[model samples]
Target: HAVVDTTGAGDLYAAGVLFGLSRGAAPDHAARLGSIAAAEVISHLGARPRMDLVAVAKSILG
Candidate 1:
C-alpha cells in the first residue's frame, strides 16, 4: 500500500460509516460504505476528494 497521505482517510471513513448509520443502514452495510470510502482515498494520491458521498451512496444503493 502506497501512502501518499494519512491525513483524512480515517476521518472520512468514519464519516461514511456514520452517514450510513444515520440513513438506517445495517452495520455491515455501513462498514462496507466506510471501506469503500477509505479505498477511494487510498487508491488515489490524496485524502478523500471533495465529492458528495451522499450522492454516491444514493446512486450506489439505487
Candidate 2:
C-alpha cells in the first residue's frame, strides 16, 4: 500500500490482533489482520481509516 502516514499504525495493529483473537482467529491469522490494519492506516493521511475496515477485513479474510 502507498503509505501516506504512520500515525496510529501500531495501535490499529494491536487492535486488529485483539479483535481477531476475540473472534477466535489463530495467532498467524490475528497477526495478518494486524498487518492489514496497519497497512490500511498508513495508506491514508490520518490515523483513522478512510475505508470500511470491517468490510475490508471480511473481503480479505473470508
Which candidate number has the best lDDT?
Answer: 2
Model 1, residue 38: distance off in Å is 0.9
Over the stretch 12-58, how does candidate 2's per-residue lDDT look in tens digits?
Answer: 99988887888778889888889988999998888997777777666
lDDT of each: 0.75, 0.84
For candidate 1, list the clashing residue pairs, or say none.
none
- lDDT for each residue of candidate 1 in 38-61, tens digit (9 for 90 to 100): 766765666755566778877655
Which residue pairs show collisions in model 2?
none
Model 2, total clashes: 0
